[model samples]
Target: MDKIKVLSIFGTRPEAIKMAPVVRAMQQDDRFLPITVVTGQHREMLDQVLKIFKIVPEYDLNVMGKGQTLSTITNKVIIGLDTILENEQPNLVLVHGDTTTTFAAALSAFYHQIAIGHVEAGLRTWNKYSPFPEEMNRQMVDDLTDFYFAPTSQSAENLRKENHASEKITVTGNTAIDALKMTVQDDYQNPELNEIFDKGNKVVLVTMHRRENQGEPMQRVFRAVRKVIDQHEGVEVVFPVHLNPKIQEMAQKELGNDSRIHLIKPLDVIDFHNAIARSYFVMTDSGGVQEEAPALNKPVLVLRDTTERPEGITAGTLKLVGTEPQDVTNAMIELLENQSIYKKMASAKNPYGDGDASLKILDEIAKSIKR
Candidate 1:
């Protein structure tokens, strides 16, 4: 059999993290030849994850430019991929999650009459603009996709609800959990981590760079965390701050100057996973962390009112604390004070996966192309 060629495309940190497992899986499988392409939509951050995964893209779109708008990114990816598709002409084009890169790449593949595979497909808040363009991006990408790699059964059902072909949908768990297999190590060391370990403090890993929680909501959550840390003597927070000027400014102003709260620069996949591995708990407004943390046996306190991964909540691995200061404070306090409650959350079975997602994805890809 000829090796099936698959061009896997992604642009952001989250997409890179989730796609790393599938890329690595394909590299080891003799049945497929994977061509990696990065749109450079998130340039530096995307490259950082690529380095961690040791994935050198067969092609880089380099579509990123200063002061680029969503429309600009969408248009550039379509145009850039025009040349890429003409060259690589893979059996399948695989795109991950909802990004301008995901939607545009799928659109371009459709234009060229090539089949597309959507990794992390069928996640929906259904409120079109709730997640900005992401909701629409995934919806449009799915419309063009020939394969659906949903991370969970619920997500597969979501695709079915939208009338996506059930035969095409594969519940492969989340590839992010699979990535931790390569990233988290016992010897992983960082200055902040050493300090936290030296102090023997209960560490709470914090990440709050969501579009919804930008200004006031972010400040509120930061203030709540600050208050909780103030009240708890043995607790410390390590926040890998996002590079967005608005988020940076707010995080520094609200959470800075606190000795217990270490505000560091954004970390790559390896560093972030290592930190999560060592943390006692996690507090975040991001979607990926909600799925990733539980596999490490860390309880995640979601900063949003709702989550697309309700399976985590139902399985007792995640708690949606929202951004309200009082609610956030209460949730934090309950975990800090109640050992049984903390144990219950920390010991819950990870509903996301058992870290075999990459193998499943590769097998499905092989079967799809073989047929």
Candidate 2:
């Protein structure tokens, strides 16, 4: 049998982090001719993860731009991958989660008449614009998908309801859990965040820069976070603020100049995962973190109104505390003051996976696709 040529394309930091494990698995396996491509949808952050995982992409679109719109990103990825797809003509194209890069790459694969696989497939909030373009991107990627490597049974079920081929959908668990195995370390320390631990402060890891939450919602949440930190002693927040100028300004306006709040530059995968491992809990609107935090047995306070990862909420590992100032304040207080509740959440079994998702995903792919 001929080795299968698998083209794995991703762009954003979240997509890169989740897909890194799968990329590494294919690189080591004999059955795959793994070709990696990046859209540079998140430029610096994307490069950070690639370096951490030691992945050198065979192709880079370098599509990130200042003030780039959804339309621009989609156009760039489709055109950029068009020539690459024509050249490689891989047996299958693999895309991860819901980014403009994911959707466009799948479309380009379909155009090339090549098979397409979606990693972390079948997540849905069903709310068209809540996650901005992400919900729609995931839905459309599945439309072009030949294989669905869903991260959970619920995610697979979501695909079933959407009428995707049942046989093509595989519940392989989330690769984010697999990544945690590689990144999170017992002795991980950075001086930027180490001082918080040295002070014996209970740490809250934060990351929020979603399109919809940029303005008022972000402000409300930031204020609520500051309030909570002010009310409690020996508690601190590690927020790796996003690079967007508006987001940085808003974050500073609300969460600035406080010793308890560490507003630092975005961390690479290793630093971020280790931070999650040592933290008391995570607070974020990031979808990947929703899966990663639970695997570390850390509770997550999802700052979004709805989550596609309902399994976490059901398992008590996540709470969807919306961005209302009072609600965010109350949720933080509850987690801080209620020991029983905290313990339950911290001890809840992570429904995401047990850190073998990358191997499962690769094995299923090899079995399904022939060269």
Please tell me which predicted candidate would have the highest lDDT against the true structure: 2
* TM-score, every prediction: 0.97, 0.98
For candidate 1, write residues 140-197 as lDDT tens digits. 9988889999999999999999899999999998888898888898887788568775
The TM-score, computed over Cα atoms with residue i paired to residue i, of candidate 2 is: 0.98
Q: What lDDT does model 2 reach?
A: 0.92
Assess candidate 1 and give its TM-score to the true structure.
Answer: 0.97
lDDT against the true structure, each candidate? 0.89, 0.92
**Clash number by candidate, in order:** 0, 0
Candidate 2 per-residue lDDT over residues 1-371, each given as its tens digit: 79999999999999999999899999999999999999999999999999989999999999999989989999999999988999999999999999999999999999899999899899999998978899999999999899999888999999999999899999988989889989888778788778776788799999999998989999999999999999898799999999999999999999999988999999888988889988999999999899989889899999999899999999999999989999999889999889999999999999998889889888888888865
Each prediction's RMSD to truth: 1.4, 0.9
- Model 2 CA lDDT for position 195: 73
**What lDDT score goes with residue 41 in model 1?**
92
